[model samples]
Target: MASSKKSVFAAFTTMEIVLMAMLATANAVMTTYISPINQALNTLGGPIATSSITGIYMIYGLLAYYIIRKPGTAVITYGIGGVVQAFMGTAYGIASCFVAAACYMVIAELVFAIVRYRKWNLGVLMIAGGAMVPIWFFFAANMFHYTKWGTSILLIALGVRIVSGILLCGLLTQVLGSALIRTQLLRRFAISRGQGA
Candidate 1:
């Protein structure tokens, strides 16, 4: 077998980096402002209404990773978002939340790594979504110690994450990616692999 070398990022530009950072910061702000909405959901106390925070993070993470197509983009995006929250001051003191966010961010990155940057199929997208996110389920289970949900139930929740992610994040990100391609920003690379110029 011949030895081969590979790169991780999908030829990201400086502008892309800054935009991803801005989106991450915006995610942090949303998390902070949505605190009340989460509380309200928790008060509802049902399977359909348990949590919302982590899902928001996943939405932004998907967008960042999709656009940047780098190994650690998700981590940086999620980390910076959490940092913004920390700056704003959180009930959990931001440090703990940041640590937790980092853990989940790594998970999201791993899913993308397994698929490689070029594979943007719905199945892969869904897998990434389920692997990393699932706000309304796991967090509630942990905080409330609700163990009534079985593995099958968990899988169902995971399925929802996957589907939702594909519909919202994956599709939207692909649109953005296509727009970038149309502008020729990605032509230097995308042209080689894609059919038309």
Candidate 2:
């Protein structure tokens, strides 16, 4: 058991850790910059508009996972992003940021685990990305009282979020990862070293 824990920890080298931290920081900043867009969407179409772009907010961790191809990549990336967002002052409040991060981490980790962390195809990545949505949506519904919005509206909002997850998060991650691989900049990472490219 101890050796197993050590191996998991050892899977993340110094470079991977640094890269994950950088990605997390970037995610925090980008999320902040996009708040105005989210607000505008909320104003125009309520939560559904905001939901449409939900995948954009979630890309950081997924991107990191795509590159790293490890068990705890999403957990570390999302965890650091949550901490950074909490420190940087998100519109969603510190607690909510952590809750959202935890939500993303749980499903991402679960999806990877189900595949035994071996698959890195577009379908699997999309499953991981799209899966990250609903749990958080459930929490958000209760937190923001979306249950009062009626079943149809709630279902619509959830559908939008799930599609956003599939397209914006999963599809975008694969696209970005491929681009990065082509640049040869990520040659040091698992993605470039393995089947990901």
Candidate 3:
């Protein structure tokens, strides 16, 4: 038990913790700015427009995981982001922020776990990102009465969200991670330690 505790503690170094905190704070602030855009999209194109950008909401957590390459990276990042969002306030309410965070964390961790946390390719990251959407989508559908939109529309929204997750969350994470690595800013992270950019 003592060894297990130590191992868990060692999983996150001080630098990792600091980076996660910064990313979480960024996530909260970005959500605040993005919320207005999402609201506008909801008004103009309904669920489809908002769904197309849903991936952006989940990117910070994925980027954290990508950089840290650790078991709980995404979970910790999302959890902190949820807490920060609660304090910062959200259009969807504090509870919804947490729910969305939980959903993203669970799916991302599951996807990474399935790969034994050994893969960091674009395909794997895309799979993780795209997989994170459906659970929250269904939950939000029920909570927001989107079920009344008919099965075809619901499926379309879901599809758009998945693709958005692939491109915006996963692909963009790789892009940003690579960019950071190129700048040598992430030299201390696992990704820069010969883990491949």
Candidate 4:
């Protein structure tokens, strides 16, 4: 187990899988309840409820990184969220939902691949956050019929996603992770000795 922990292939146990399922379910419910507003907000922010929650998605990847820290753990988290969101979100029978989600998985996986599955490092975290790049360009642009945002516009959007991901996932989720470690629920993943603040 210890050897596995250091590898990027570390997988979530049954309990952690169930726990992520629960968290995804909860987030989806909240997302659905706010669908109308979320829709409008997404439009205002650009499209597809991105940038804002892009970090939230990164947080999931970071969680998986903490546990598995492997080559595919980050990818799996993206897929898990996609499936869970589909199960819980309105989706409205729109094909765009599936396409956008798949795009997210692909792009996020690329970011993790570039970082070689290290999420604790700031550069890796930034790369993970930057994974939203193609999602906005390819998915939102082509699949959703969005107006062609120029390179400058795209950079700004990417910046929002990266910052959001770093703040929410890298920082906030780190707090949650630290707490869990103190409780010993996550000692296998966390190396620190003190009870996390």
**Stretches of candidate 3 above 4 Å error?**
1-10
Worst 10 residues of 1 by lDDT: 1-10
lDDT of 2 by residue, 32-87 (tens): 89999999999999877888999998999999999988788989999999999999
Better of 3 and 4 by lDDT: 3
Q: After superposition on all CA atoms, how large is the RMSD of candidate 2?
A: 2.7
TM-score of 2: 0.93
TM-score of each: 0.67, 0.93, 0.93, 0.66
lDDT of 4: 0.57
Q: Note the residue pairs that clash in candidate 2.
A: none
Q: Give the alpha carbon lDDT tens digit for every residue of 114-197 in model 3.
A: 876668989988998899999999889887889999999999999999999999999999999989999999988888975532
For 1-197, candidate 4 gives per-residue lDDT tens digits of 67644553555677656655655556556557656665677777664345566565446545555544445554556566667677665654445445645665576567667655544555555555555545544655555444466666666766666667667666665577557767876554432422111
As for candidate 4, its clashing pairs are 8-69, 8-70, 8-71, 9-70, 10-68, 55-165
Higher-ranked by TM-score: 2 or 4: 2
Sliding window of 10 residues with minimal summed lDDT for model 2: 3-12
Candidates in order have lDDT scores of 0.61, 0.89, 0.89, 0.57
How would you encode candidate 1's per-residue C-alpha lDDT over 56-127 as one tens digit per residue? 545777766665566677777777777777887775565556765675687777777666555655556556
Lowest lDDT block of 10, candidate 4 = 188-197
User: Which of 3 and 4 is ahead in TM-score?
Assistant: 3
